[model samples]
Target: MSQDRDEASAGPQPAEPERGGGAATSSGPTDDDGALAPGAIPEDEVAPRSKSRWAFARELTVIVVIALVLSFLVKTFLAQPFFIPSASMESTLDIGDRIIVSKFTPQHSPLHRGDIVVFEDPKTWGSVPQHRSLLKRVVNDSLVFVGILPGGGDHVVKRIIGMPGDHVVCSLACSTKAGPLTVNGVPITEPYIDKGSVPSTTPFNITVPADKVWVMGDNRNDSADSRFHDGTSHGKLGSVPMSDITGQVVAIAWPISRIHAMKDYSNVFAKVPKP
Candidate 1:
């Protein structure tokens, strides 16, 4: 019996389990499954996250506005879109081709012969027939003013054939084969013109007036250019004033398959004497 009592008191036998099936732990912030309790987020961190999001949005808005303003300014002063509307330019430029005309080049340098140029239609020249209604016209013009569209009313594109004081003449019988088109007593070979198209169908002889330029389309048969207005006043109809020039077309940008630089014909006109 004394031995049994010694074994019973040996180091403190395992304590009886708590009243529950398993031993209970000290109470604290925990679920029955032992997951931690949710704590309140700091007010400082919450406000900063919200403010940061708003700040990012504001910065994005500022950047977008700046980009649009820069684009408008560049289109207005440096270069702008130009679209070919008719077949007058033919093999050189096709209808629906988009081009970029450089306003800066014409501003700094004198206009040269053989340069494809965009100009304002002279008052006496016939207006390009527009099939749109009045409302459509107004909307189109508004878009152009805001730098959205390429061209507006009263704008025409042609190749420069004569400058001030140039004496230009063409065959009376519609024959480029018969050595047509002479400028300042020098014959001009226009390889840009379409095959089978004569230099001119009607007779014409004119000396470009002072401070003016004579322009013609490559598709001579279809073009109503300086050749059509020969019977009118010297400076008023047959020639465009230097101030009327908008820009020189440097490149065709649209229709990815047809992308190309508008070639300058300086070599073709090299032998012609300046008038």
Candidate 2:
């Protein structure tokens, strides 16, 4: 028993290469670490693996720092990415499309009609919990910090069809023509809309409240706007206060092939009737 015990206590026995010839003691750890005393690691096995790991860590830190700095600059003065989730702006923005919403203009002045802007989500949309989508949270939260979002994601992006105190109705009947969206009392022709979408499928007749504007998506058939939330006590669902309006979407900065300034609705607003 003593002799057997002595042999067992002799520490790890040398692992001889098996007849099959691969790494010996395949189930156990290999002596690749520098801590292996002297001959445990062969001359061929010696390399600057630790130094390589340290180099990798340093490079990764630099990349992260660059990303953070760019994010700050983007949130401060320039444009940033926003992922489109719904079909509200259908032809303009499809799901998975990344749009650039600027933070500079709205910070300086009131938004003009036809400007495509991102606002804080309305109360209903603003309260949806985080973790719903990491991309949404990142874009929404970034916009919030820059004052681009109304209240978190409560903001929305739409064409300003009616300005403060404008009595805007959806349709104006015509004998031989489809009625147009009227601001004040004149018909404004919007040629930007997708041909088949009927503007304001839901009826709306309202004097845009003081200090507020009426907004709607160009893709009128599939949007939830002031008309849909008009009577709900949830408040401010249908109309966004002028103060809640944020900077406009100036361009497309991603998917490189599609980059261009977001067309201003000025052409449409040009024909709107004054009160």
On lDDT, the candidate that comes out on top is 1
lDDT of 1 by residue, 1-275 (tens): 99999998889668564565332343334468855334423334445677889999999999977876776787778888878888888988889999888887578878888999998888667666668899989988766765678884578889999988898877664353577688898989899997678888776778898888999999988887887875746434779888888888999999999898888799988999877
Span of 10 residues, lowest total lDDT, candidate 1: 21-30
Q: For model 1, state the Cα shift of residue 228 in Å.
A: 1.9
For residues 1-275, what per-residue lDDT tens digits would candidate 2 score against the true structure? Answer: 99999998899878765564344324333556634332243545545799789999999999977877766677667765565667787677665556777777677766777777777666533345446588878887665565354332344667677777678776545212377767777777777665578767755677766666677787788877666666543224567776665567777655677777787668777766555
Best by TM-score: 1
TM-score for all models, in order of appearance = 0.76, 0.65
Pairs with backbone N, CA or C atoms under 3 Å apart (clashes), candidate 1: none
lDDT of 2: 0.66
